[model samples]
Target chain A: MTGRDRSGGTRAWGLTVAVLAALAAMWPLLPDYNQITLARVMVFAIFAIGYNILFGYTGLLSLGHALFFAAGLYAAGLGARDGGLTAVPAFLAGILAGAGLAAGVGALALRTAGVAFMIVTLMFAQAGYLALLYFNEWTRGDEGFNLPAASRTVLGLELAGADMRYGTALALFALATLIATWLARSPLGRVMVAVRENEARAAMLGYDTGRVKLAAVTISGAFSGAAGAAYGLIDGYAGATFASVQYSILPLLWVLVGGAGTVLGPLVGAVFMFYLIDLTSGLTDAYMLVAGAVLVLVTLFAPRGIMGEVRRRVARWLP
Target chain B: MDFGPHLMLAAIEGAVAAAVLALTALGLSLVFGVMRVVNVAHGEFFMLGAVLAWAVAHLVPGPAWAGYLAALVLAPLLVGLLAAAADWVVLKRVQYDPERTIVATIGLLYILQQATLMAYGPEARPVAAPFDARIALPWPEWGPEGLVLTWPWGLGTTAWKLVVIAAAALLVALVFVLVQRSRAGLVMRATQFDRETAQAFGIPVARVFALTFALGAALAAIGGVLVVPIQQAHYLMGGDPLLLSFIVVIIGGLGSLRGTVVAAILIGMSDGIVSVFFSPTLAKILATLLVAFVLIFRPQGLYGTRAA
Candidate 1:
């Protein structure tokens, strides 16, 4: 790599190091509550990254992302609740459930483009949410469900404490980041970018644009499911709220505000949004108002997002 | 249940729902037709109109009829001005990119919803009808044991529903006349068809767009005001309508007023009839599924022309 590439790669590596360092430093100082918050933020970042694959890479806006997220949460929650599976198997089940759900929805929704795609995805997501609500006996509806506290074991190693959960979350976050980075450099990743740039042209070049979109959505859903399972395990609860329209949009905002094109963007955006939510909740009861204002301001002034802005400024300084 | 009364009620409910949905969807369709941006915040404009109508009625403290009249005339005009200003400030800047505009409008939706919550405190505000009077239609009743017939009447019943329906119809008629016969409407149609060509022909394309946005806002506001009598105005009232309007616009076809009207009516009737047999939540799910199926098969919608 050249100096520029080296610096870019270094910056990416530095982010992981910084996050790990911060986690290590804060481990002893953070209470259970803050640990839970950090875990939630990391999980949401995972979810947002999944979203960025489809929205950022493929240029398809699927409003029903919560469907996949919820599928994972419910799969894990139900599987673990019934005592049929442990943490690892339940987590895998969740990922499978999310992927299946995305594949099914993507089959029909990927047929159209633009607003139609948005509406179809939204329709399926809402349908899934309603189905959960209607089957209240199964999902417990809006009341939500709690997971029994069990010692999480990873390959014969016992992880029972809050610290262990934190470590587990960090490991999952790292794995997700690594996978996302690898995918971005893969041939499939290049095809996704090409599809995003021009679907017609991509199709003209003998690419199955529909299959590419579906594959991206399916993979994205799998990661989102992983995130949801982590969320359920860490929080010890899962609800239909995880599948709501609000949850669906929050990630979109995170991706947009942090910058969608970069792997680091969703991570930074998630952390920024989570902290912003915490800060704004302290300021006013209307956290949504502040969020909305931020969305508007970002879209209007910084369409390239925070990371994009930083890159531009850094480039100007270097030149 | 008597078939006559059941059918009558369903018809009335369907027609009223259709009228309101059509008026709202028309504005949305028109905006999308001319400027390919789907205004996600259109529903908020509708909610604002409803809230304004309630505010005017409550603050003025007049005869119920007078309050209704005031809301009908003033609420839309005021909200239309607000819509025009929003178009000027935010939408005009991002007109070239539909996707960016979608994001921007979604942002605007958040701001408007938050502003509403800040103002109204997240509570549902009920708007009282001007008159307590009800019109009852006597029905033939059939039972297992005996035959009984009675006129049905209640608070927020059929008469008020009809009144709202009439107002919506009037607005639709007005829009039709304006678009079909008026000079401004002709200019708008010309600009929508070919922006560059219209500009080349010395037509004020920018002005047409601004005016179209304002008009769409005004129509949405009217729908909002009409809906307040039946449903309470709240901060989140805009969300359901926004989703429903999307379905209507998609089914009707983008940029076709006639298509929007038909789609809205179809959706409204379907919702009403489905809700009667099934739960409201289920009805919503069904309606959404129906739209999804239709879009998958006929991607351009029932009336939409294929994009070039």
Candidate 2:
């Protein structure tokens, strides 16, 4: 490989290492509240990353991603509530259920392109939300469902408190990030990009565009499910709000604000947006307003996102 | 079960719903037809119009009817100017990238919604109907064969909503006439069909785009103002109609004005009928699912060309 290629590889590796080290160092210093908040951010980042696979990679925007997330949350919450399963098993059940639900929904939704995809996905998500509301006996509707205070354990290591939960979240975040990065470099990933660029051309080149999109959406849903599971476990509560339109749209904003189509974009976007929410809420009751303004500013000025801008600047400096 | 009352109520609700939905979808359809950009903030413009009307009607010191009239005339005009500014300031920059435009509009939506929340608070605002008069239809007597037809008292909100609907229909007809017959409409059609060709012909393309967006915003604002009495005005009220308009635009086919009106009626009637039997949430689900089925089977919508 050329020196430039070697340098690029090194830089990517370096960036990942730096971020990991920083997170590890900050873990011990974070307060209990902040730890929980960080966990929430990581979970949302995972969700956003999953969304990126469809929107950023496949060039298809699914407005109903919250459906899968809610599926996971409900699955885990119900499993735990039933008293038939432990936290780990319950979480696993949630993940599987979420993936299954997403796959089923994606099969139909991925049939169309552009606004059709958006509208169909939204319809499915809204349907899911309505179903939950209709079956209020199970989902508890607006009041939300709470878990029976499950302890956290990792490979028989009993760390059954907030710290342990935070660590577990960090570990999951790492795994999700690694998987996303690897996926982006995989052959399937390349095909997704090709499909995103031009579906007709990709089809001419013997690629099954629909299958590729379905796969991307399914995988994305699984990751989002994992995030939802984490949210349930950490918060000890799950509600229809998790499945609402707001959840779906907020993550899209995160992806856009953080610079979608990149490994770090969702993470950066989630952290920035969550903290911005905290800051705005503190300043005034109209936090949504500030959040909305920030979104507008970001979209207007930095369509590539903050990371995209950083990457561009870094590239210029290196050259 | 006697179907007469149900059918009558459904028809009345459907007509009102269709009138408003058509107005809202008209702008969205026009924008998409002309600019090839999906303005996600279209609903926000509607909300802004509602809020503007509320403010003007309540805050202005005048007779109730006069204030209402002023609001009806001024709110949409003000919103149209705001929309035109957005077009020039934000939308114009992203014209080359439609996806970017989508993101930008979403951001605009967020900002507008939040701003409304901050300014108006979360409370729903009531706008007094201009007239309290009720038109009563006589109740039908029950038959011996266990069949019954009953008509409860039917009341219309001010004649204003019907007037607004009529006026809007007339306005849309005028637009159609202007677009299909006039020189400006020819330019708009020409530009929509081929921006390069229109530019080549020296037809100021950008001005047409700005005008179309303004027109769409104005239409949405007009709908918002008219809807105030039927539904209370509020900041977050735009979301439902926005979703409905999106479905309407999609079902009607993008860029087809005729399709928009047809789809709006279809959706409105479907919603009105379904809600009579099903829960509101279930009705929403069914409505959305219907749209999805259409989208999957016919992505170009019921009337439009293939998805672009």
Candidate 3:
């Protein structure tokens, strides 16, 4: 409360570039297993970044962002699989779908706040998940459907290959990070923070808190949807599993672990959690047991998350 | 089957569903009403109950009825104690802030789920019912005579199903008596009505919260024990009940016990009939949307006067 964040100062762009370069540089030295895990981490990082914009920046916590992510995933997947659109077009469609769905859901869900907001979003997402199952003849339900390697190609460059896949995943993750950083430093971003901190005060000062929330959700949804689309391209498949309540919770976990509201935190969190599960999984079937405990411990000890704590103690210039 | 028998069959199945749902939703309603916190792990507690029942049932070296009886008594109590511990360790630390409570409970949900997956293998194992005499149902229809009783094939339900309904009713009555007519209920109501005021007046608010959390978990566990005989005990099986009960609590007007019971029965009983006319998933979609719209348009539910 004392040292309030003052944007436009912290060499944030340099930090962003440094992180991206480090990710790219590390890809060459890593083994195949780590590379794949790293790629998967980026996919989730993108999701957490988008989620942070709403939860961290805008102060709205949603339990149904999976609906938007799935909307993007299915759109991109089905477009490439059936619509015969190229990968790029499909990905764009995914972004549009994600943003579109978020707008739609946020419009109604934002009517209620706090716990009620969580429940509304959750119900809608659950309904969407059921819809996926109900239309399994097309969506393939829980098993999901695959987009062929040919459909994954961009300008005859096959995305099925590891190098291309990882590169594309990194590129998208970079773009998502840039978007998050820009938003965090932007005036609109400050308005979102204002809404999060004191909506009544922001409203009294002639800000439309509702519109700010809706915009935040829309952008956040687009990022989530884009992540889902990227997953379809990189993983070469899209499944109903990605649209489950678990999917929604994963981004939330990543954002929390890495540092919510920090541009680099989502990626950091995603990397940490992915390894946490990966390493734990090799040892036992109940990987989530450790993950769950981590969540509980983190929530108890690091209420502000890894990045949040860092921002508080080490660097007041995190933004 | 004719429409008459089909409808009746649907009604009976719905009643069975409603019976279990009412108890589960009522538990959720009590927690929300008293503590003003949502227990996302409530379903996991139910799953724990069923799993424990299976363990107890198998461990007891006696008849299926003996195992069933032991499980019926032990499952809920154990689950309640576990819930109380969780409240003390986690919720108490967070001071029951709504948002933090959500996150913490979600973590608790994952812990319980993963633990169950570890302990109880990923099999949907069933518990043997204490008594399951299949009773054939008779429908009345006008024949050559003024009235005739026709036995419907496949219109039969097990006696255990009836017992479930009866037991649910009894438990509901007990809950009502405890909350409305007991000294403890008075304390609980006071805490719910005003937490700070209750604390100021010498009521142990923290202890009340722990007890209420335990009670809610116990109710859900009892529901699981009652259901495991009919359904199966699986770690993943908790999802639907949790979703359904949460919806019931919301639609019943969020923290209204009477409203929760009525909504549970209406939704549960109508589900079979609705699915008869439509697919079950479709019915679920509609129900989910129904709750959202209810919250959106009429935050106060059909029977609830309190605005959500």
DockQ values, each candidate: 0.60, 0.60, 0.71
Worst 10 residues of 1 chain B by lDDT: B138-147
List ranges where model 2 is wrong by over 4 Å.
Answer: A2-7, A150-160, A198-206, A315-319, B1-3, B134-153, B156-168
For all candidates in order, state the fraction of native interface contacts they contain. Answer: 0.63, 0.74, 0.68
DockQ of 3: 0.71
lDDT of 2 at A142: 79
Say which candidate scores most in lDDT: 3
Ranking according to TM-score, highest score first = 3, 1, 2
lDDT of 2 by residue, A11-39 (tens): 76667667867887889999988887888
Candidate 2 displacement at residue A77 in angstroms: 1.6
Question: How many backbone clashes does every candidate have?
Answer: 0, 0, 0
Candidates' interface RMSDs, in order?
Answer: 1.8, 1.8, 1.2
Candidate 1 lDDT by residue in tens digits, A76-113: 98988886577898889889988888888888787777
TM-score of chain B taken alone, every candidate: 0.91, 0.89, 0.93
